[model samples]
Target: MGNRGGILPAVGALALLAACSAPAPAPVAQTTTPASASAKPPTTGPSSDAPALGPGPGSQPPTTPQPPPPNSPAEVTSACPFLGVTESSATMGVVLDAYAVEEAKTTQQDATTYHCTYASRTGGRQLLDLFVTVVPGTGQIPSLVTAWTKDCKGPAKPIGGVAGTTRTCSLDGADSGDVMVLVVKKSHGQTRLAELYVRPFTDEVYAKLAQLLTDRL
Candidate 1:
């Protein structure tokens, strides 16, 4: 009976040891509530468990820039004043059809006539050299010619009558045979061909200019 009693206790000890040695079941995940369980869905970007941020002052949308329009005449005019035609009205007794860019003073040593000219709109040709000066003390036309001739060569042959109590002479060695210098005293002002030189020289152009000075100036 003693042996049997000992065997029974040993069996009980083995079963307890087996129960302790068995692999522990995986621990179940707890169903407890997390601190962020009742939190709202993110309205902005994701972040750590920080508090929801309120909108800051004046968070308006960004503005987009617009491009300027092409083919604006006002912009072009503002940029290039010379690109447009500059015309003289018929009222300015002495009028030019084109813009007259002021030239540097001629190299002539003794010059009294204040000279300016408008280039032709037609062919980029020089239309006329407009001269203005005080009426001479002497009634001599040659003196005025002498004053005009200081810059230019002396003169060709003196030609009589094309217009207005005036005598003309071609500047000697002038490249253009169409070149001539006339001296005239008109009603409004003294309109003279101080020097009229044209390319592809011809006497016809010269004659035409002489007549124009007569009819117009």
Candidate 2:
């Protein structure tokens, strides 16, 4: 009976050890939320409904619009200022009454010019063109004289007792019949150019007319 009792205790101890060593039911196979589902989604770019930005304070201001320039070389009244019809008729020995004038302005150079034309009253046989140019600065008169007398082939003959430098030239051509050009420069940088077309070109008459015009200038 003692040996059976010992055998029963040993069987009970084996059952207790087996129960302790069993693999703890495999931890129940846990289910949890994924990391991607738990975290916030990443942004793509700026929102389409956002407000637009304007120019900044440090940026340059808009430029102001400029005004346009005036029309150049426009015609004006046809009255002669320095010379008149009576004086031109007496000088050229013809009857002159008709007169016409045109004006031109150079804003860049700050200069103004007036072109006066005188014709005979009888048959328009005799004609004279006088151009008066005024520039504000000095050294501008020579260029005007050069431009006016560029077509004349005669040598420049200086005259005496004039306000400024005076020169006369007679052009040489059948098309340019009896053409005499006279250029006079005044003290205040003003220039007067005269182109005469008469039947007979007389130096004495041209000198007298030049004197009268320069005296008036």
Candidate 3:
């Protein structure tokens, strides 16, 4: 349902509009966001109780800090190249033959972004898309994702490995239908935005990937 990094999204990018209705709706054509997509600084919350942190360093980022000039293809997202299942290590039972990986050249202007999509060879269904947006700050992402939990279906609970929280969203018939998971955690001086678009994943597997990614960062 989301773009796979750069300007263009690979196959099945649009087939993900609506998720989990009794009978899935006809897949609607959707356009991916351009590479220049910018993230809006999260809106101010109830007298914001969080403090921003200084940018130091975390796990080595995937790509070079300075990206190529605009309009060029972005580098492969750095942190989790281990994503995209194969014949040996499949994700959730789907043996994805291949995956589409791309990086956001200018995500949110100041943040770095990476996206990966794993799916069948013949196309149609995009089993999963792992999106990571690394913005420089501390507590902002955790605060933002936590704030979002208030309207979500599940309770926001803490998980080990990463310093963050996880929550599943409730449907308001306003989403793309994918049962997604939102995990926000902190590393040295950056906040991680790890968003997964998958067919309902258990908290265990979700935490595994979250830890793996956080460790990579």
Instruction: List runs of model 2 lying over 4 Å from the truth.
Output: 1-79, 100-108, 120-123, 160-163, 173-178, 188-200
* Distance from true location, Cα of 158 in model 1, Å: 3.3
> Candidate order by TM-score, highest to lowest?
3, 2, 1
- Tens digits of per-residue lDDT, candidate 1, 1-217, equal 0000110011111000000111112222322332111121111111123232222243222221121232222211111111111212222233434443332222111112223333343333333333322231234344444433332344544444464544344333445322343434433332222233222234444554444444333
Q: What does candidate 3's lDDT look like per residue over 1-217, in tens digits? A: 4322321112111001111111111222322432221233221111112221111243222231222222212323442353435421333554544334342232433554455434333434444555565555574553455433433335544554444455444222233344545565565576655555554445565566555444444
lDDT (Cα) of model 1: 0.27
Tell me the TM-score of model 3.
0.52
Per-prediction TM-score to the true structure, in the order listed: 0.36, 0.50, 0.52
The global C-alpha lDDT for each of the candidates, from Candidate 1 onward, is 0.27, 0.35, 0.39
TM-score of candidate 1 to 2 decimals: 0.36
Candidate 2 vs. true structure, TM-score: 0.50
Better of 1 and 3 by TM-score: 3
Find the candidate with the highest lDDT and give its number. Answer: 3
Weakest 10 consecutive residues of candidate 1 by summed lDDT? 12-21
- Comparing 1 with 2 on lDDT, the higher-scoring candidate is 2
Error (Å) of candidate 3 at residue 163 is 5.9
Poorly placed runs, candidate 1 (over 4 Å): 1-98, 101-114, 119-128, 134-138, 151-154, 164-178, 186-197
